[model samples]
Target: MFNITQWSLKHWLAAALLVFFALFPLSGDLFYTSLLNRMIVMAIAVASLNLILGYGGMISLGHAAFIGIGAYSVGIPAYYDIYNGWLHLALALIGCGLFAFVTGAISLRTRGVHFIMITMAFSQMAFFAFVSIEEYGGDDGLVVNGRSEFFPFGDIENNVTLYYVSFIVLVAVLYLVYRLVNSRFGGVIQGAKANERRMRAIGHNTYKYQLTCYVISGMMCGLAGALMANFSNFISPDMMGWVRSGELIFMVILGGSGTLFGPLFGTGLYLLLEEFLSRSALYTFVTENIAFLNDAQPWVYWQLPFGILLILVVLYARGGVDGFLSRWGSKNG
Candidate 1:
């Protein structure tokens, strides 16, 4: 049996990724650095989703709602002149965790489609709440005046400083997830996924375990949301919408669920493809080489290609990119 207790210390892909991220900002392009930051942020969120979906066997469509909660966690406090970063992050995380725990407790009473629907409903409730925060900017959203200033550490508004902070958090979260997935609690959660009925019959309170995992996932995503709000220096209701939730799901699916590093790869590829296609289309339209696309915006049409790619991956690659890569490597070896 492969020892679950022992993990390869020299994880080549992860190590390579760490080196790449460290060097990316040295290129000094604001756009590239900013995009990298966004990718890392979304990657963290997607990893949070995988904890429940891949490990705990919970299908939550409203995962991004926690991120919305987190963003507003800091955004609202900042609006009220609470500029302490650590305090704001702590409050947001605690609030999101408590909210998720309450919601998950109720939602875990149901299973399968019912659980999914209930979670979706809860997320919608959050979406409406943000929209109703008229004191903050309502539908139009609020432009952030500046990011939280960490006393003595200097301004977090600087891109390089923010990037490093985000990178450290991402690494820290990933390590925490690694520990969680290998712990005693993780065994029960994975068993629950494989056979909840058997786990329950064995005297495990599966509902509690599931609820705990759900709340942890939410709190982690909330952290990502807080970082995102700071990075973008803005907050809006749209961040909590169904579309944002769908995007999180897509990131998980695209990256190959069940793997620790898959989400990072998935988010990177997804964002890069979007950027490249959009830029190419803009250049083509300006040059008028592609006659049919001259007046049409490329981004609106890029979804068609993305949709096709999703269909292909679903039909041909059941295990996602990680699975596909493993198979290829084995065959080549």
Candidate 2:
């Protein structure tokens, strides 16, 4: 639990946001409710990446593979009528942990570009492996007939129930990451990131610490993937595609990789930008009003602006969105 005594501007704002989300379903807007669910799930996934990229100092281009594994963990079972929530979650955790362990063991042996490529290579291997299996619809993917069931406790019958469940998971994941990053294990990780030679000389066994961190991050992302599978009721290889992995990286960097609330805020802003450029009235305004350039579809070029903005952040912002917020958010604190 977070101490109120340490609450700053962003913390209070996050609390307010959570309160609003808690009460939001009462309004009964199904579209936005579902949208918020995606934001929460994406935030969870990105937060897992933060643990590796921000604190663990490892850059991975294949993190989405865990999410895919997690999704398939749910989807494959549902195909055969196994909807027990515990079973689904357990598979997600175990499958991702195993995958992470194998990949991290090999990837950690290298550093720089070699490390990034190996991790991605392993993720692509998983992607193709799933794609080759015809039992689960091959590249077409699998469908979940029903949401995961928890039996005596409850089941995700409605989007609202899933919404709250996902939100709670997000909070739990954040707490877990917060604790891990502040612990001695986290110290070793960041230390290795700073000076691997020094950490190794001090008897840290940096490789072991990093592999553990890698596995932890993968398991967390797997949880998000399970929730995502339940939410969308579908799973495809594209869910673990390299493009999606890149998006996860974008969100982490955009949100500030090492900061606690960065992923949450970053995912929110990313989705908001998607909404504005792709489905919002702003697109309508551009398509409907502009005189000589009416043929121009500004939404199609959405990434142009986003790419420019990201470049600015990379060049200018120290800690991404979190750093920018801290400047103005902690005046009184």
Against the unseen true structure, what C-alpha lDDT does each candidate score?
Answer: 0.82, 0.89
Q: After superposition, how far is residue 283 of candidate 2 from its true place, in Å?
A: 3.4
Q: Candidate 2, residues 1-333: lDDT per residue as tens digits? A: 368887777777677877877788899999999989999999999999999998878999999999999999999999999899999999999999999999999999999899889888988999999999999988999988999999788899789999999999999999999898899999998999889999989888899999999999999999999999999988999899888999999899888888898998789888888776665565566557768447775656556666777788878977878877777686655
Q: What is candidate 1's TM-score against the reference?
A: 0.92
Task: For model 1, state the Cα shift of residue 226 in Å.
Answer: 0.4
Candidate 2 CA-lDDT value: 0.89
Candidate with maximal lDDT: 2
Clashes (backbone N, CA, C under 3 Å), per candidate, total: 0, 0
TM per candidate comes to: 0.92, 0.93
